[model samples]
Target: MQLRFLLCLCIVGALAQSDYDEDDGAEGKKDPKEIQDPRGHRPVSRGRETYSAGPAAPPPISGGSRYRGRPTAAPVGKLVLEKEEQPDSGGCNHMSEKMGVLCPTGCDLKKTVQKQERNVRPTVDQLKRSVDELTQSTNSVYGYVLDMTTEVAQRQRVSEGNGLLVGQYTDSLETQHAYIKDAVDITFPQNIKILQAVLDKIREKIQRLEKAISAQRAKCQVPCKVSCPIPVVSGKECEEIIRKGGEESQMYLIRPDPLGMPYKVFCDQTSKNGGWVLIQNRMDGSVDFGRRWDDYRRGFGNIAFDVGKGHCQTPGEYWLGNDRTSQLTKMGPSELLVEMEDWSGSKVYAQYEQFTVQGEATNYILAVGRYSGTAGNTFLNGATELFGENRTMTIHNGMMFSTYDRDNDKWIPGDPSKQCSKEDGGGWWYNRCHSCNPNGRYYWGGSYTKYMAKHGTDDGIVWMNWKGSWYSLKSISMKIRPFFKQK
Candidate 1:
């Protein structure tokens, strides 16, 4: 607003300056014979007339007089002689000299000079004042823009903080609501139930409002000029993006859930007939995997660049977040693919025909079936006999995700002292623990040394049946694609 006002003032000033120059040009073309009386008389009329005097004597005037003697034969304006006492001999000697004029009659030169000085001085002064005002307005506008930028930055920071707070609050409510409800019901019965009902209504309203806000944010998040997919109605996943003319394996925006804001995802357009969303990738150790529950829920690392850190030269190390993964997979029939590379450059993969991740209410439970690939089916039945009878319990299928902060693994209820994610230094689905711990620590070499193990566990990225628990893979990626049946 301030910028617009300053621009208007500048335009007005320029127009005023232009108009003043035009007035000066018009003044230069004024008739010499038509002069206004400084003391409020009518303009003198111009006519052809001749003045005859002895020897056509030069008009007596002092200091660069404007008047010139008119020849008897030449035509000139008739000079109006005012009624005034005749001047002394020293003054201009002409019929018009008695009125302080001379020859083909210029105005009293003194009065013309006084009128010009009077008109021009104030105009110049006004222009100077206008220039100063414009400069001041420009300074003010610049200051306002700077302040507005700072305010917007601060608001963005605050908004991010609020998002974090909302995530935490929602997680707590989802995780512990059963316990909270039981406690409240026992304490006050009817009164507490009424209050709880009111709270539920308020929560529902908040959720609706959040969905509305998310929709608005999705619309504005991507620029119109960009080839970003339309939110809510289209481009729900990488497959949808491919169908809509997307040809490259690059970062694309998608909104899997209609009530959620759009987010960036790496689309693998050339992999396995295309239309795969890269969910997790770890080639280098640039990004730490030992994050808390909220971190896993919201994701971390950079998804814009597909290449990871350091020498591996593959997709970057990042987690796509549990919430978005669940939203994506639950949309329809989805397939999961896990790819890994050993130190010797040999690559292996595990593909699941049926795959889905439940929401946070189920602790983001993993569901996979019909596995077929080079890599062993460690997800359901490929744990070594290291645990003897407990080998079956090591399967990661149907296990809830666990993190260092929120332990939802099977070991947490049986033996609280043995937390899979805490001992492994990463978050993942654990059943007694995982057979394939892809989110585990990244080791420098294929084999993890005994000294590198934490709590007597090799937490390195391990697909046990393919490379054993002690061997840390060089690179690993987990991606998913929805199955689109033939029309």
Candidate 2:
């Protein structure tokens, strides 16, 4: 029994030793290197001494031989103690504990972080200052841009205003230029014509003056027994005299007469110190007494009595004879007279005087008379008689004369177609003879006498009336006198 006990004791002791080796390290102490953290910090080391609270109680020995080969477990409390004693053996949960225990590398990290923070502070300040400068510069640029914009707008407005003004001025100038051009176009030619007319008048005067000078020189050099006398009047003087006559007579003295005497001649009796003398009458004694207007205009046929014929009568001249059927005979130049014998054997006559008018010698009758008739018988009896007798005088000289008609108080002229009536008896020729005897013992004569004998008379009167009607003239005595200028 003693030997068996000894073997068992030895086995038990070996088991306990094995268990201690497994539970604790082989040295039964923690290594500082193994306790280092992931942050590279080493744990503070405890002294290399054995750790014991007191003597531990022995574990219960197993009686069976099965326990002989097996190791024993340590106490639970001792395992927990071993875990707590290790340095940095825990995970990230132990980082707080290492905060107070810095390693060499940890100090370098702390210093680097502090240096970077210090550098960042200055950089932040510089960045803030740079930002402020940039903002201010931007504001300034914006203000400058705004000012430029405003100035540009203002300049644009001014330009626009100037453009409008320029446009208006251009339009005004154009209008004025057009007006001036039109005025010049309308007046320029007219002004030229007026100037040319004035120049022509001046040239005519100069020519007249030159001719007068030549005539004066010739008159002084020549020695003749007789010299031509200067003219008593000129064309201008004749016009003056006519104007005076118009003023005195209150009449328009122009040809062809407005009363329809187209055969009238305008005699400028300037050289005879006379005014206008009209020659207008029909001398032809044909049965058809109406004169042609064209023949009268050309002074042809019976209207050709001019100054060259003096007082001689033409082939178809007028005649008043006792039988009233004798051929007409011309009078002598010196004794150019128109005479007729009344039923009482009294001689009635008309005489003329000769004068020069506008370089043409003409004869103008001044008086008509009944030399052996009763006193005042040569004077006109009625307006119609005066008109007829004045017409006879006009035929002798182919001249128109003014005869005062007492009935109408108007001058009568020699126009065959002139309007006449008892109410306004103021024309040489008449279609009706008023206040006279048509079929009395005294004869009534005129252009209508022959027509009256052929185609009977109406109301005891004869006339070459319009529309082929015929009428006879009434008997009335009349006398005529030439019209002279009032000097």
Candidate 3:
């Protein structure tokens, strides 16, 4: 009943404080204790875990312990708080114990204080999420604001122009906003002290809000300085950029010298969902394996690359592999191919795609990748060359035009016997074997052949070879041979 009354008293008193503070608004709020809950029904608990005293620590080895051996003793000490009694100054801390009145900090306190802050605190995971988001937001905000400031600063400082005005009059407002943002949360306290701090900071700026706004308008009106036109990549004006020119999605442009790219990853604020990603020449962060990411491309006739610390600093050079299993189990192993998709000027395009390896015999593969980009003449930058003992046609996309295996130094001719027609039959097999085909000339991966057997080839390359080594180009000039695996 007493606890209930206390809660009522607190509520009523809080309402009273609220009544008079109407004018104060967000900033001018009264201390909580000033308010009273007439009903006295306040939220109260016996205490935290330790407070209720359910399970006590096994009695310490003290004299009180009923041990037959040596005795144990606990040192008794007293803590004294010296008080210089003074008249109560209408403060919340002021309370009369004799009058049965009580006052405690508006803390979310439980009986047992040692129950861990977690009981009344956010979990580590929650804190981490909040921190990550806040950090991202903070970085994002500063990125834009700093960019604006830098642009203005770079414009040859206008002696008697915009620079001088921006550097002076409106600086305080910006500074105040910065101060509010920089203010961090203090130790958890009953009163929302941090919130109050933010409010105070806002006030500092609100006081001069009009002056700052006017100044902002005046300075920004004439514009600051303009920088010289400079090319960012390849020393050319990037005025026109192909969406897929450099790279797209999760890329890093880290080159050598000072540094290839800026950040390790493409943290472009403009790319929220996903965007173009360019791997630069030089980078710092390394990709770890075994204990890190599991690789699904090991074995199954798939060629493996070096496993180590790697980053996509430069586009041309990249090292990606899995340390686990190294290859698949049941089905045959896959063939790994790092194909150079495009090369515009100094920039290169590369994506990880797989190819199916055929028989043990070394057979040269003549394939052309599709490039319908008619923006200009299509030129073959060449292919990623792989050399070893056995040479076989592993990568089997639907055979398109033709490919000349440089390693084999031979031009593979397509079969011209089996009634060659899109309606008749054509796929990875058709592309190379439209007519009476030779054995071992073109071998399809089990997966693709089986798929094609099921899917019809009348429309597109045999359904199985739809996504195979088949590609059409305006023209095919030179042939490049890829890495040849040992039999």
**Best-matching candidate per TM-score:** 1
Preferred candidate (lDDT higher): 1 or 3: 1
User: TM-score for every candidate vs. truth?
Assistant: 0.50, 0.22, 0.14
**Candidate 2, residues 316-351: lDDT per residue as tens digits?**
221111110000011111111223333234433333
Instruction: Candidate 1: give the clashing pairs.
Output: 308-316
Can you write out model 3's per-residue Cα lDDT over 353-395, one digit (the tens) per residue? Answer: 2233222132212223333232211112211131221112322
| C-alpha RMSD between model 1 and the true structure | 34.2
Better of 1 and 2 by lDDT: 1
Better of 2 and 3 by TM-score: 2
Off by over 4 Å in 2: 1-114, 125-129, 201-487
- Note the Cα lDDT for every prediction shown: 0.76, 0.34, 0.30
User: Which 10 successive residues of model 2 have the least lDDT summed?
Assistant: 322-331
Rank ordering of all candidates by TM-score, starting from the highest: 1, 2, 3
Instruction: State in Å the error of residue 307, model 2.
Output: 50
**CA displacement after TM-score superposition, residue 193 of candidate 1 (Å):** 58
